[model samples]
Target chain A: MITSGDHMNWKDNLIKIAPYVAGEQPDKRDFIKLNANENPYPPAPGVIKAIEDFRGADLKKYPDANARPLMKAIAEDLGVDADNVFVGNGSDDVLALSFRAFFNSDKPIVFPDITYSFYPVWCEMLGIPYRTLPVGEDFNINAGDYNCENGGVVIANPNAPTGIGRDLSFMREILDANPGSVVISDEAYVDFGGVSALPLLREYDNLIVIRTFSKSRSMAGMRIGFAVGGDTLISALRAAKDSYNSYPLDSVAIAAGCASVADRAYFESTLKKVMATRDRLTAELRAMGFEVPDSSTNFLFAHHKSRKAADIYDFLKSRDIYVRHFRKPERISDHLRITIGTDEETDRLTAALHEYLG
Target chain B: MITSGDHMNWKDNLIKIAPYVAGEQPDKRDFIKLNANENPYPPAPGVIKAIEDFRGADLKKYPDANARPLMKAIAEDLGVDADNVFVGNGSDDVLALSFRAFFNSDKPIVFPDITYSFYPVWCEMLGIPYRTLPVGEDFNINAGDYNCENGGVVIANPNAPTGIGRDLSFMREILDANPGSVVISDEAYVDFGGVSALPLLREYDNLIVIRTFSKSRSMAGMRIGFAVGGDTLISALRAAKDSYNSYPLDSVAIAAGCASVADRAYFESTLKKVMATRDRLTAELRAMGFEVPDSSTNFLFAHHKSRKAADIYDFLKSRDIYVRHFRKPERISDHLRITIGTDEETDRLTAALHEYLG
Candidate 1:
């Protein structure tokens, strides 16, 4: 019998995973939540109607191993065939599968050190080694700095925490430099006015881009996530998914996701509201004397040397308003990651911050 | 820059993964799907109602990272603290997480040679080695055979394909023998009629039992699965889930799963109907000369050596009825996995088989 001993001793840089820390979810109610960068608005009416329309059959029956309808809708929206797309419980699920498909090399994976904290954790868990590139002094990625011989590059476009994003031109350049490596652009927050890399799918076969309905779509509770790439890349992800969990998305998720995706008008309108709110929120934070990064995503990363983010976070928590602050990675220590909520939610957050600063 | 080079150099035990083949989802028309064992009933009305209640909220919002409500409901049902349970996309997701938490070691993980095919796949993906313990000639696990020290033990109670289960006493004995390792009882089909090993939770902290909404609860379309174990074991899964995908179950899935669990009468009625259908179908198949196993699941595993499982599977498929068949693991090749369906659906399957056989 083959023992895990041989496999255990043959480790692949497993110790380096600094797991991603997300927002708190205490059972207590009445707390204002501005953590984990979730959108504060509810989903579209159509999405709700669809969920209401959801029918349960024998709970013993497995869901469509292939999320047929959900995949079809996504492909139609992306202008691709359903075969070119794969959906899962969350974009994080798809992203994890991507790590398995794209980063199974002796070389390392390159991404902004301060990017999504989940990237490194995926590397460690999948036994895939990774290399982190510190963002430039301005807290932006120096795309050229990812000069590795073997490993590909992954970047959360409009990156997380810092909330800085780059244009497609730089992404193309990054791909040009590492032609052999896979370039994955996780566009989780893309619909918030950032352009999608999906247009470039035809340009690079190694390019795999991931998108989620959580931010722009507001169906986070339904756990639907997907990826768009060359058929080969998508097939590889499909293989991993099939081997891992065939039916990751349930019926309610598929119904809601299809409804959410099809209601493009609602998606666009809600996104416009978020963008407008984000602009106002950023401006308000800046005027309050905090250094707010020009965010491309729906969330803001702000800090004030006058008051540490930790102290501000603590003060807000006392007032039932919650935001995000990280102590690790040594960079972005003063930063508080705050999600842009509704006007009312934003008001509550801004009002609470003002009191804390005072 | 740490590179994925180390992982690139890695060759997973691809050979060990006898890929799990879920039921075929044909696009032409929605036929009677008995391929993968899923509940035939829709979720309770309350489930859809809960989803509808939250439809107006933007689904783009990040889900509650901890899945507090769903976990709370699950804990209440299991009669344990919420901390003892962890919510997942499906039981498979929890099972995959278990591979990393309890079974990631140098020792060999052990399970029946012919059990859930996905078990070994998880081990292979995580680089955990395993020993395949053969079931006795009657096709059941003899717990005494697993005396060696290893990473852990995984058993799909009322094991799949065969759909036969061992009683709680045997499970307890095995848990006692493997005090140093985790013993996972995948009760995906347990709620149908199989006795739950859940009571053993008080007796053994080493035991982690997995459950799903896909069966018995009649919410396969909802894509919800959960795990209950010692708080320490649950914590390991929680840590992995946080680092991997913080919000696996979507809002609809969460709301639906909660409602399904809450609606005891609806759930019980559906299970009763499925159990009744399963019993009737089992007897009918035996009368027709198929060697049906004593099933505690919603499905039956049976076949005739002269009348091949694959041949019957194909015949049923042509007639728009589907069942699952495996090409690997020589032990069960002659067996066809048939999920008990609605009375009419079973009639259709048996009718198709009778026509094909005659």
Candidate 2:
């Protein structure tokens, strides 16, 4: 009898690193699922129609290798040439490809210590050395910290967990400082009042602005994301993507993504609603003695003045509400990242908070 | 003016290799599309129903990171526990992750020279060294060639382009020889009358049998694929997948894939039709003075007695037909890989070939 271990220590030599632990996804829908920063609203009306009208027979063929129609729509939406776009399964896929495409020098790539946890995971997966500069005391990325020499730079514009947005000027400063390295502005949450570095592509050839349909477009389940960059950088990313997985986007995703991008009015309306809810939620949390950041995303990162974040998270979970609370890095261990739910859901959440705090 | 090249030769350090060129995905429906080896029939009836019944609102939330329902369905269909199954965006993604997961040692990995082109592309992308051993004049994998020391092994059963299937004994011989390395049997075309390595899983803990919906299940546009192996190997693949893209399989893909697997009758029926078309096409090609291989897959690999493969490919294209003709690796450059289409499509293709040959 041969145990799996009887084989060579394949796990030791294999790229065995800890995988990124995604937010808890409880099966039952009864919970106010604020854990994953998912959009509260459904996808655009056109997107729903596209899904409904999708031909079942079309699925027999492979999806467009170039994801051409979807690329055209995203290009039009971003006011960029289709040649400047690269689409993938999600921003994670896009970012992974970008890491492989641009970050290759012996120098360590740099990103914020407290940004999206997946950044370091990608770096580790690709065997790229990386250094994490700490964010400011306010939990915002210090642009000056990224001016140093590196293989590349990845910044989550409106950085995750902190819900803080950075200006185009900040992005420009980083790009200007690191002309030798590729700069990726992960604008996953940019649609929710966050300024995108997309317009800066004209000035910065090294900049790649990555966006996703998961949050603002309300199509997380469809798994669509893209990067808008200079034609050269986009070409490089495409080469890497092709080498990895030629058809990352499926037919359903491509069709629904096209419809979602085309319905600009619906996209904006949902973004506005989510922003309004987030603002309201921020004020309510502050009134309850929580120090909530001025969120540029649909979620608020807050720490209570008196109550513990872990306790609040536990209480919320017990009350059938699910908000994220990271215990790592210690600095933000007391903070709770609460995704903004619908107005009614917010009301229920506030009521529950009142019961716990009062 | 900073030219795109002025800043840095990021391309030099970054992964820059010729990407695997996928078969032509022509847009117009007028052509009798036979390239890319995609299924000629539509996805299963249950898959169509699942797509129709799919809820657009669910796109707001992320897909189940574990792909629980899809995993369960595939596991049940393969008569394996859920722990033995790992799902991904496609077999390309699965194979990519598997390469990163298993083929990591300094020793070079091994595969057949005339096998799937993407295997070497993946090795290049992952920075893994690999050597290709030549298949016999029969174009069948010689399992004896894989018994030596190596990092890992990857075999495409009913191997691509050639469409020749090896029996379980062939697989057993390779597995028995390579207890120290992770052996991957990419059974992408196995459902089309090819013997699966899945049964060998109980006997060989080091073996992984990768399967895809693109070929046999007729869901190429859905981008669904899985691997059945020992629990430990599946866990490693899942870890690698999570590290790369936590949600590689989207919600729609998961739901549709489950439905496709549930309808066993439809799955078997499509396979039978494709196999029948393939058999008929082989006989017809042989009669037309083409030397064709005995194919267990939904495609036929054939070379004309006198005409050049490139010329045949061009002639077929002129008649609004598409067949794959590889230019590189000179051994098979004279052969064309033709996918099995519907009976009507096949008749048209044969008629067009007759015109070209006669």
Evaluated with TM-score, which candidate comes out highest?
2
In terms of lDDT, the poorest run of 10 residues in model 1 chain B is B7-16
Q: How accurate is candidate 2 locally (lDDT)?
A: 0.88
Which 10 consecutive positions of candidate 1 chain A have the poorest summed lDDT? A7-16
How high is each candidate's interface RMSD, in Å? 6.2, 3.0
TM-score on alpha carbons, each prediction? 0.90, 0.97
Model 1 segments beyond 4 Å from truth? Answer: A1-22, A25-31, A58-61, A305-307, A347-358, B1-22, B27-31, B58-60, B351-358
Question: What digit string (tens of lDDT, one per residue) describes model 1 on residues B1-358?
Answer: 4344533222231123333455456877768878777677766878756766755464656566667789999899879999898888788888887777666567788998988878877777778888999999988888888766777889889888788878988898787677677889999998788988999999887788999877777676666788998876777777777667777776656666778779888888988999999999989899888998889998999987479888888888899888888776777877888888789899988888889878
What C-alpha lDDT do the candidate models reach, one value each? Answer: 0.78, 0.88
Model 2 stretches with alpha carbons more than 4 Å out: A1-12, A19-22, A27-29, B1-6, B9-12, B19-22
DockQ of 2: 0.60
**A239-304, model 2: which lDDT tens digit per residue?**
898888889999998999999988899888998999998998888888999998898998999999
Give the fraction of true interface contacts kept by model 2. Answer: 0.68
DockQ for all candidate structures vs. native: 0.37, 0.60
The docking category that best describes candidate 2 is: medium
